[model samples]
Target: MAEIVELSEADQQRKDLILRNLQESLGVDKLTKQLSTGKNIHVYWGTATTGKPHVGYMVPMQKIADFLNAGIKVTILFADVHAFLDNLKSTFEMLEYRVEYYQRVIKALLSSLDVPIEKLSFQLGSSYQLSEAYTQDVLKLCGHISQRDALRAGAEVVKQVDSPLLSGLLYPLLQAIDEQYLKADGQFGGVDQRKIFILAEEQLPKIKLGKRWHLMNPMVPGLTGGKMSSSEIDSKIDLLDKPNVVSMKIDNSVCVRGNPEENGVLQFFRFVVFPIISPRIIDIKGQSYSNYDEIVESFEEKESISAEALKEFLKAFLIGILTKVQDKCENEELRNIMNHAYSSPPELDTSELSEGFQTVLELKDMGGDRMKEIKGDCELITSAKLYQKLNTDEPLKVLWRVSAKGKVNLGHLGGLLQLKRLQALKCECSILISDIGGFLDNGKCPWNALEARAKYYEEALKQFMKAISLENVPIRHSRENQYERDYTLEMYKMASKVTKDASAIVEGNTLATHLCPLYHALDVHFADVDLLITGEEQRPFVILGQQLCQGIGLPSQAALLFPKIPGMNGERMSSSNTEQHLDPLDTVKQINKKIGSSFCEPKNVKDNVALDLARLIIFPLHEGKEVVIKRDEKYGGNVSFSDYAALEASFAEEIIHPSDLKPFVTEQINALLEPIRTALTPQSKMITAAFPKVAKKK
Candidate 1:
């Protein structure tokens, strides 16, 4: 029995335009159904703004022209980002310039064929790729796929190397996301990107998006009769090439008789020349090719339609089409774009030097003994190998956390100073004020006052950052983003995996205290936090975060532990306990009074708040310099300790009295607080708003 499929006049035209010359098509029925319903299909063709457009690109250009002729809306996407993410072939710096070049050049290409530029629209990936909804989808996509799948999906398109960049895997995911985000009914790309297209087909539905059609054009051979590549100038002819140059390139191209399969000349006429030129006819060497098939037929036959005849015919046809393209590419704007887009990439310093010297040079400000103190209060680093943010200029995102249950204190201020130092080392740190967590901590942060308290903590930190010249550091209230689309989704995943373990470790029953670990862990994924700068007390959070790295599938965060800072009573500083620490916003008289009565035992230096003030507060603030203890001539007359160790040893052996140390450290501490004190004046209202005075009961 014979079966037939019927198509309306308009539907057949649209299908032919869309499917003609396509090497592969997915969801063809889905596309036909849309056409049957009188729906105008929107097909987007994206080109990564990486390299120049060549004669090989004409294959897709001819197809794009066909889409326009069929009355389909076409969006030419300048994928400005995919190139940067594709093994950094084009970096973020070159993205803007290349995008402009791609836009101009692609338009010129379509205009060269008179592809009806009116129906064609152009858009950039950056325009919508960074939106909140889109970013949530990206996060969702990350959770679905494994590292192996991501690697394989992009293996063909992303440049392969020994140690591939994470951005390379992200390249395909971003491209897959573009299919749904652009609202395209189908995507148009080369068959080379079939894996990524297939990835989109499977992953988009998981994210609640319908599977779209994929239109793939076959790979056309270059002038060398091999793959057309942007890197090899001789392999393809540039759109802007002069007639003589194009003729010369065409003349030298490989086109063997009866070998159209690998013949570049015959492929061009078959794919591009005949598709756009008209009448489906070409006269060559007393023979004619009314269609691409006739030329292929000639190639299969011996002693007919010689390679030179085909090359000569292709040369004239390309020359005619390139006249407008060359004219369009010669604009002043294009020249400027080319100059910037193709400029040399930044090079790394490669002068030969010893490894030890290189390490020292890389350390810069945080060199030698000072590096030990930078660990703050932590006894151990969880993942020592991942600690590369230090001493290097590579930018890494640092997740700096603080519980906004109480006012800012000197203990936290000292950590901020270290955070500022890391900022100098090129770490982009952001403060996550866990307001919602604080609210759940059995009224440590009252429900009614959560937002206010959060604002206060943020403002106080901002004032401190300004004093330390780190005013640009970002500060975010957790409650503001706790319920964010991706955050909440990942929070559930984190909650499922490790909530019991988090509950097992913590003594407290408060929701925030137990859930804090889970929230902190999930922040590594949602926030893309590369490093966690926290005191040793928060070790469990980092431990759980490492476990979640597998389930969430984002990069894990390395925790840098700072040794816990001692409070006035010689214990880990508590923001909730006013007696244990001095307020950063304290008055000079308050500061002096607090230090005068603080616990500083003579002949004992371990975890002593007073010595800590000297080591953490004074020395680091003074750029790791020596401290002088001011006193009378008989009382060791202005004794000096060259380092924190010397000072600690002297205090341990009773050489420096707590009495003398108190006044000297107090004076230095006040001096250190001066900038913050001054910056706090204008921002006083933030404190007033955040921590409003409570009414006392009679």
Candidate 2:
């Protein structure tokens, strides 16, 4: 008995399209059912106006053609505003130019790909994004969503910096709302947009909208065997890249033996080449692969094609495939569009370097320039490392002392890894925290030194204290007699007599839990260090340090304050919650467990353990290196990433799952810790002997 499964016409087409190179589709089956009844489908996809469209970029363009062939109305959103927010490297004035360039280039790409141009509609983000209704919707969504959620949604698309802009938060909300205003029945984009699409699907109904289908295509791997990125020229073959450039990029691509799963060139052939130029047999010299499977099987065999041979075939195949696009680019209208987009904005005079630093460039030949680049703070002394951002002029000798009684954690050493990369000077110190209690150093204290110094500036501490308002002082944790009994008030009232602004006095705990400021201030002079690199939370400390500087006859603006590193859990990395911190000495299994247990909301990238590790560890440790993750072919196989941003983008799109990510990160963690592990053995023994981890009785 033979059994047959019957499929409706629309179901067959739907299954065909979705099962083809499609990664995931939400509501596609329903959309297909509707199509079977002859209902029209509205689909929209957007492109950022950041860089040149490459072959990787063409993947979606070709997909859009497929949608039109299926009788779907396609809307191409040229996201000008979104592009600007994401690409901080581009100037604001260039938005219009970039969008126009994007539109024309997209049109040319479609035309070259044989997609129907007349039926496709194009819209710029500014057209609707600035409208009152759209603006109101965006604001409404912003009000409902947490900053964490917004940040997570945009993590893949947004330009991640040490200090992300407010625009980053706004970008995701605007995108989610754009789906509402566009009235798209279905949205098509690269897999990276899956999170944002999910965001739209969840939030749109609450605000005011019909739900839309989410259709996503697999992201094309870059020439470097990672997600294709516009920023990395060597990682991609741009649509505008010449034959020589394309050849060079492909030639340099990562092509391991018998690994088509991670091989960008092979994946490109399966996804782009076979789909576009199909029905024609692919013949390489006398040998020929009858179909995509044959080719893949050949690559997957025990003794498959060599990397060099694959590259040579790819180099030629890509040239033949891109010939039409290259020819289209020669057209006057196309050339003019790109030229105008790249035209320079109005130029302004740049600021000159302060004084003779520019003229003394040759001083770099001498150690004077080296001395000029050294900078440090109290943290630096404890970190036992010098960083590039610390010093830039005049050599300053610094002394680092570790108290025999102070508690030392391996976590501090982990933090030093970043500073080490910056090429800071390294020094070791032996000082005790108990010895430096409230600036009263040891049984042999530094207080007498401070008191002796304070004699010179009798009213300096008071003067400095009075200048800052107690109402908004930095100390947050309240204690008994916080207001009435404190150094700040005593000093403020005393110094009020000297200063002009004498608003009624107020008081709060000056150095409540610790004497870090006093130690920091004295450490500046004791160590002969000038700059104190700290966080904004330590601003009040810096102020206190400034007062100490006055008392010690040192410069007031000694601390260079930067933002703190955010924790994987979205809190400050230095939070009292020990779970938030990762020690350098943690075993690979321990690291994996901690990260796996940490928060990772699907498609949400904010405060993500994996993303944080990528930024803080993987990228820094493996800079200019190729990192790969192995997976089954069904799960997109072994994917490689060139940088943290590329990895973030992939994670954001849901192309890489947390399960896959945790193990990969575990591998990387152990790899990074290997050398450090070996080097810290002696130090660990000393640290453990001096300061064992013991519970403090409350």
After superposition of all CA atoms, the RMSD between model 2 and the true structure is 26.4
Candidate 2, poorest ten consecutive residues by summed lDDT: 470-479
Error of 2 at 34 (Å): 2.7
Tens digits of lDDT, candidate 2, 448-564 = 232222221112212222222111111111111112222222222222111111110112221111223344444444344434444444556555544434432333434434334
Report the lDDT of model 1 for residue 539. Answer: 74
| Model 2 spans with C-alpha error above 4 angstroms | 1-11, 302-304, 331-336, 343-698
What is the per-residue lDDT of model 1 for residues 1-698, given as tens digits with 9 covering 90 to 100? 32344679867987887898789998787787888777878999998887787877788988888888888889989887666554445545688998887777878887777777888888888787766677556655755665567668877776676545555656787899998888899999898899999899998897687799888998877888767877789888887788999999989988776567788887787667876766756688878668887778866665576677777778888888788887878778789888899887665333322112122234446432334544444543433223445455456677788877776877786568768877776567788887755644544666557788887777777767776566578887665666665565455444433433333354553233444565666655555666678887777666666655543444555678776777777777788888767876788888888888877889887667788888776777666666788899988588877778888888888888888889998898787677777777678666677666776858
lDDT of each: 0.72, 0.56
Q: How high is the lDDT of residue 128 in model 2?
A: 66
